[model samples]
Target: MKHLTLLVPDGQSKLSSIICTYKVFLKANAFWKNIHGSDRFSIQLAGISDEVEFYDGLFSVKPHVNISKIAKTDLIIMSALNNHDYPGSISRNKPITDWIVKQYKDGAAVATMCTGAFLLASSGLLDGKSCSTHWAAEGTFREMFPKVNLQTNLLITDENGIYTNGGAFSFLNLILYLVEKYYDRETAILCAKMFQIEMDRNSQSPFIMFTGQKQHGDEMVLQAQSYIENNLQEKIVMEQLADTFAIGRRNFDRRFIKATGNTPVEYVQRVRIEAAKKAFEATRKTINEVMYDVGYSDVKAFRDVFRKITGMSPIAYRDKYNKESAVA
Candidate 1:
């Protein structure tokens, strides 16, 4: 039987993440017994805390074993930390993080859910590997772990037994993924059916809200972003924008990218796409109309950019999101 440890971190963790994952794996174990007449997994909750409270004391979790007591595990799953103070969260959970590192070094696989990637990245294991996290935390994750490749569009990133999933509550897909890996395809499908979760969902792109990265405090770059947002329909010439700011074109591009995490060109595309997404969600605009409204006149160019960023074509995005469009 594969030994699984669901980590209960020392700090604020999404209580649902730990509870739901535990329940699913337990169901998987029972399903395996029905198929093979034997248990395929052994699951336990391990933590440093005797009991952890959550959501202002609405719930509490007591792990099956203290992390220090469990010397070996076949798999270790870290729950998402809801706290924002990354440095402080990591420092307080040093023992837990160190334990995770030790387990991985001793031939165990590690997986993190949502912002749980923070703890995993801090362990230096994801130093050169790719990871996925909540889209809203993209700036913070990038700034902290420049060595770790953060892919926000992908729902999951699996490399060398280190797994990560994107955003809140999407961790269900990761659990389903793990079930398929450790148990069997049939059992995974059954769990998917039981939980009513859409299976084989590889992209989290459609759910991402592209609020422009604005944390970097560059006044000129901030003004440039506002200009782009205000004039989404206008032809935004990068060089002309720089001239309007009275700064050199080259210097303008440099500051814009450094502050907003996108070049002047890419920023325009994202803002336009974001506007297009909102239009598709809230308005019944036809694909071509929405395209023109977002400043893309050419049909092919708009479709390509929409798919490149959102993982779906214009009509597909509209049909999936807009009730009126779909009904029509």
Candidate 2:
């Protein structure tokens, strides 16, 4: 049997991630037993401590085993951490990081859900490996782990046995992925139906709310960002922006890329696309109208960029996210 260890961390962790992951693994084992006349996994919740609680003591969980006692595991799952207290959560669970690293070194696959990527990344196993996390935490994650490639657009990433999934509740998709990998496609489909989870959701881009990367202290870059955001309806010229900000074009490009993690033009396009997304969500405007409102005059150009950024066309985005559509 495959040994699956769900590493429950200390501090304010997402209770749902732990519980749901355990449930799904149990279901997978049950399915396997019914199919093969044997259990496929021996799953356990392993934690640094015996007990952990969250939500002001409304919920609590006690692990089946202490992490230090686990000599080896076939797979390790890191549950999502509370967004508001991730730093404190990571610090409190530092011991778990070492354990995770040691386990991976001894031939175990590690998977992280949502901001659980933070803990996985903390273990240094994700260095130079692609991973995904909650979209809202992208800036902070980039700042913390510069070496790890953060693929915020992807719903899940699997690299050398390290798996990660993106933002809130998307952990279900990762569980389905694991089910498919370990068991079979048929088993994963059954699990998906049991959980009512949509399978093969590989992109988080459509769900991302691009808030513009503004975490840096570069005053000039901030002003340039504000200018692009305010003038979304108008044509934005990069040279003009650099000249207006009294910075050389080369220096401006370099600083903008460094501060915002996007080139000047790329940043402008992201800002426009974000605005277009909001317009589609809240208004009944035609795709062209939304595109024009965001300063794209060419229809094909707008559609391509929108699809590239959101992983869907404008009409599809509207159909999926527009409030009226949801009501209907």
The lDDT for every candidate, in the order shown, is 0.91, 0.91
Worst 10 residues of 1 by lDDT: 253-262
State each candidate's clash count: 0, 0
lDDT of candidate 1 over 1-328, digit per residue (tens): 8799999987788998998999899899999998788788789999889988887888899998999899789999999988898898898888998998999989999999999999999999999899999998999999999899889999999999999999999999999999999987898899999988789899899998998998898999989899999998899899999999899988999888878778999999999999999999899878889998999999999999999999999888889988988788
lDDT value for model 1: 0.91
C-alpha displacement of 80 in model 2, angstroms? 0.2
Please, what is the TM-score per model?
Answer: 0.96, 0.97
Local error of candidate 2 at residue 49 (angstroms): 0.7
Q: RMSD to the native, candidate 1?
A: 1.3
Clashing pairs in 2: none
How would you encode candidate 2's per-residue C-alpha lDDT over 299-320 as one tens digit per residue? 9999999999999998888999
Model 2 global lDDT (CA atoms, 0 to 1): 0.91
- The parts of candidate 1 lying over 4 Å away from their true place are none
